[model samples]
Target: MTLDGHCAAEFAGVQAAFEAEFAAGNEVGASLCVMVGDDVVVDLWGGVADEATRRPWVRDTVATTYSVTKTMTALAILVLADRGRLDVDQPVARYWPEFGRAGKDEVTIAQVLDHTSGVSGWQQPMTVDDLYRQPDAAAALADQVPWWTPGDGSGYHALTFGTILAEVIARVTGTTLGAFLESEIAGPLGADYRVGMRGGLDRIAPMVPPPPAHVDLASLPADVEPRRTLGNPVFSAAITADPTFLAAELGAVNGQGNARSVARLQSIVTGRGRAGGRAFLSAETVDRIVETRTDGVDRVLGVPVRFGLGWALSSPAMPGVPDGDVCWWTGLGGAVVSCDLGRGITVAYVMNAMAPGLIGAPRPNRYLAAVYESL
Candidate 1:
C-alpha cells in the first residue's frame, strides 16, 4: 500500500495480517512510518478512525503518542546539554531551588531522567485542575517527599514525570517545554508534532478503548508491580480525558503527533544527534544520554528494565531491531518509536486504540519483526 507518494510494501504478509486484525475487531485506526536515514521508505495506515462515524484513518490524522513523548522531552534536555546550558550530573536543585526540599539536594538531573528520583506519584489525591495549572502541580511536587530514597531504585513516575522535568527545564531555560520544542526542534525540521495541541481539536483522533478485559491480578504473582501500576485508578484517570490536564509543557506524557514527527525527532538518536543537515545535539551528548544507569527490576514497574537518561535502553525486556544500538519507548496503548543507531533507522507506530499495558501489543512486535527482516 502506498499513500502520498510514499511506497510501502506490506512485507511478505503484513497487509493480510493487518486486515485480519481489523476483521477480528482488534485495531481501530493506526499509522506506521519507517525512516532509513532521511527517507521514509514505508508509510502505511488503515482501519477506521471512529467506529460509529465509520471515518477512515487518513495520512494526516494525529493522536496523543503517550509516553513516546518522553523521547521528545529527553531530546530537549539533550539539546540543552549540547549547548552547555545544562549539566545532567548537576543537582536538579541547581536549576529549581524549591526541588531541594526534602533532602533532594543530591538528586542529579540524570537520576530524574532515569526514573530513579523516587517522586513517582502525588502524595495526596489530585484533581485534573491541579495538573492543568503548572504552578500548583509543581508546587505540590516540590513540597512532597519521595516514596523511597532518590536513586535507590526505579519507579515508573506514571504522571508526575512531566511536571518534575518540565519545571526544571522552565526554570533553567525560562521557557516552557512545548514552546522550546516548537521553536528549536519541530519548526526547524518541519515536523508535524506538537507538545501542546493548538485549537484544532476536531481533527485529532480519540483513543479507542482497550480490548475486552481479561486476566485477573489475583490469579498472578503477588510481586507483579507492572500489573498493579497498570490497574491503578490514579494512573488510568490521569491519562483518560481529564479536563484540567494541559497538554503543553507536560513533557513526560501527552505528546500529540503522528508517526512522521516521532521518527523525525528521534532520528537524532539514531543519527548521533544530527538529522537532515541539522545538529540537534553533539555526538558526545547523545552518548551520555544512552549510557546505562540501571538494568534490573524496577520498583514501580516490577520488571527488568534497562534505563538510560529518560529513555529505555534496548534489552531483552524491551526488544528492538536485532543487534542495533537502539533505545525506545511506547505510548500508553501500542504507539511505539525506536531509534536504531546501528542501522540508522527510526520506526514509529501511532494508533487510536489504547492497549491494556505500558509495554506494546503483539501487533507491534510482529510489525517490528517484519521491519528488521526487511533490513
Candidate 2:
C-alpha cells in the first residue's frame, strides 16, 4: 500500500511493517506520524476503521490514543507551572484542599505527577458511568486516601492519573482537564487531540484487540512491574470494555487522539518547551522533568521503570530513540509517544488494534529506529 504523501522509498520498511499487520488482519486500522523539529516527515495510515461496517481509515480518522494522552496531560500541568499558576513542589492539598483528607495533606503535586502518591487505583468499584461523570468522579478521587506513603515509590496510577492531575488543574485554573486542554493546549498548538472527546464519534476508529497470547502474564518475567499492574484480573475485563471506563479522563490512560496530535503536542518537550511560536513551558521545567525521581523497580509496574514529573524517563523497561534525554509513554494497547530532547524529535504512533500489553509493542520501536536513522 502506498503511504499517501509520505516518501515511500525513505519510509518503505516502516510502511511495509504496517501493511503486513493490516494484511494479516492483526490490526484493523492505524496511523503513524514522526515530527523532526517542526517538520512532519512521515504521516501514513491505512485499513478499516470498523471491520463490520467496512469503513476505511482516513487521514482525519482519530482514535483513543490511550495512555499516550498522559504526555499531553503532563504537558498541561507543566504549562500551568510555567505560568506561575501552579507549583510542583507544593502539596496537592494546597490547591485541592479536600485532597488533604485521608492523610494526604503532605502529598506534593510532583509526587502525584510521578505516580508516587500511592493512590494508584480507585478503592471503590467503578463503573463506566463513573468515568464519564467528571464532577462526582473527580471528587471521589480527591476524597480517597493514599494506598501507601506518598512519594515512597512508583505505583503506575493506571486510570486515575488524569483525575488526580485534572483536579489540580481545576483547582488552579477553575476548569475541567478536558476543557482546559482544548482551550489551551490543543487549540493553541493547532493539534487534533482531546482528553474528554466532544462530538465526532463517527470519525473515531474503535480499538482492535491484540492476540490472546499477548494478554497472559506468564509469558513475561514474574518480577516485571508491567506484569503486576497490568496483569490483574480487574484490568483484563476492563480492557475489553467496562461501562465506567471511557466516561472520565484517566490521564494515565484513556487519552484519545491520533498520531499527528500526539507528536504535535509532545513536541513541546522535544523542542525544549516551545512549539508553534508558543512557550508552553520553560527550559528549567523541562530539565526538572527529565531529572530522575525513582529509578528502581516500580512497585506497581514491577519493572525497573523510571519516573520524572508526569512523564516516564527512558529506561530498559521503556526505550525510545538513541538519545538518552528522551521521555516517552505508552497506552494500554500499542499506542506509543516519545519526546527526544537530545535529537529535537518527537514520534507518535496510534492504532485501533489494542495490543494486550501495558507498554508499547515491537511495532513502534521499528518505526522510531527508522526515524533516528533518517536524522
Candidate 3:
C-alpha cells in the first residue's frame, strides 16, 4: 500500500493511521485531507480507483460522497441566510408557496436545515430516475404530509433534505443548487467538488458496496419512521456508478468530490465563513451552525444525534470528534467531513471501498482520533 501525498512533519501520526487502514485491507481507493486555518496539513491519496482498469487513485480522483452532500447543500442555504436572501426562521412556504400544502404551511427553513421538517422521505413510490426529475420529486414532497409532527424531533431526511431545499434555493436564488454552489462557493475556493457531475466520468471512482446490513423492511411496520424514510426509495450503493445518477442534481446524496476537495470547500465554515481571501458567509452565519436545533434520538437513524443548522454538532453518537464549536456529517459508505471552529481545523476522508453502516464508521473515527491526538 504505497500511499502517495504529503503530510506535514508534525502530523506523521495521521499519515501512519491512513497507511495502516490501507495495509489492513480496509481501503481500496481513498483520500484524506486535513487543513489548519489556511494551510493544508495533510493531503494524501492511494490505491486502485477502478478495480476493472486498476486505475490509480490520484490527486484529482473524485467519487460520489453520499450524505456528505448534505453539508454542501446546507452551506448554500446558510449563504442565502447570510445574504438576507432567505431567513432561517421564516416559513419555507414564503418562497415556495406550493410547499405550504399538506399541513406543512408552518414548516420553517431552520427546521428543513436541521432535518426536523418531518418530510424525511417521499411518501409516494419513487425510482432513481424520479430523483433526476426534480420538478416531479419536489412536487411529490410538496404534496405529501410530513411523517411526523414538525420540529418534534428529527427523522433524518436522508434523501429529501436536498430535494426539498433545492427547490427553495432555486426559488430564492434564481439558479440551481449546483450552479449556485459552483458560482459562489466551490469555484471561488478552487475546490473540485460538484453537486452533480457534468463531464468528469473518467475521474470518478465508483463506490463499492459493503456487506449488506440486514434490515427486514417488510417485517417493520409501514408507518415506522426508519422503514418509511429509508425504504421509500431504498438506494443501492452501486447506483453511484451509474452516469445518470452522477449527472442528476440530488443535493442530499449525489455530491461528487474527494477528501481534499471536501476539506477545501468546508474550510469556509472552519475559517469563520471566509476562505480563499473572500467572505462567502458572515461570521454571524458561521455562528448559526452551532446553534442546536434538534438534540435527541433521531426517529429515522435510530441514534441520538445533535443536529445544528446544516451539520451535526459534537455528540456522544459521534465518539471521536472533538467537542466545542464542531459540526460534521458522513456519507452512506464511509466519507466523513468535519469543521472545528474553535480550533480552526477541517478534516475530510473519502473512499471508494465503503465500510458497513452510515455514521460513526470505524475508519473515519480512527483517522479522527489520530488527528485530535496529534493536536
Name the best candidate (by TM-score).
Answer: 3
Off by over 4 Å in 3: none
lDDT of 3 by residue, 201-240 (tens): 9999988889877667768999888888888787777787
Give lDDT for model 3. 0.91
Specify the highest-lDDT model's number: 3
Q: What count of clashes does model 2 give? A: 17
List, residue by residue over 1-375, the lDDT tens digit for candidate 2: 544447436666666666676776676778888787888877888878776588888988888777788878888888998899988999989998988888889998898789898777666657655756766666777777677788888988776777778888988988878788889889999898877664676777777766675346667775454453454324442342332344456666666678988889998898998888888889999998888997787776667888888888888875544548888888877788888898887888888877665664777776777666655
Instruction: State how far residue 338 of model 3 sits from its true place (Å).
Output: 0.8
| lDDT ranking, best first | 3, 2, 1
Ranking by TM-score: 3, 1, 2
lDDT of all predictions, in order shown?
A: 0.74, 0.76, 0.91
For model 2 the local lDDT of residue 139 reads: 78
Candidate 1 per-residue C-alpha lDDT over 1-375 given as tens digits, one digit per residue, 9 for 90 to 100: 222325456353444445566677677887777888988876767776665577777877777787888888888887887788888899889988898898778888888889898777676557655667777888887777777788887888766777777887899789898998889998999988888885555546777767644666556664444444333323442243332342555676778888888888888888898998999888887776568887888876667888878788776655543544678888777788888887888888888877776674676776777677765
lDDT of 3 at 58: 96
Candidate 1: residue 193 Cα off by (Å): 1.0
Per-residue error for 152 in candidate 2, Å, reads 1.8
Ten residues in a row with the worst lDDT in model 2?
A: 232-241
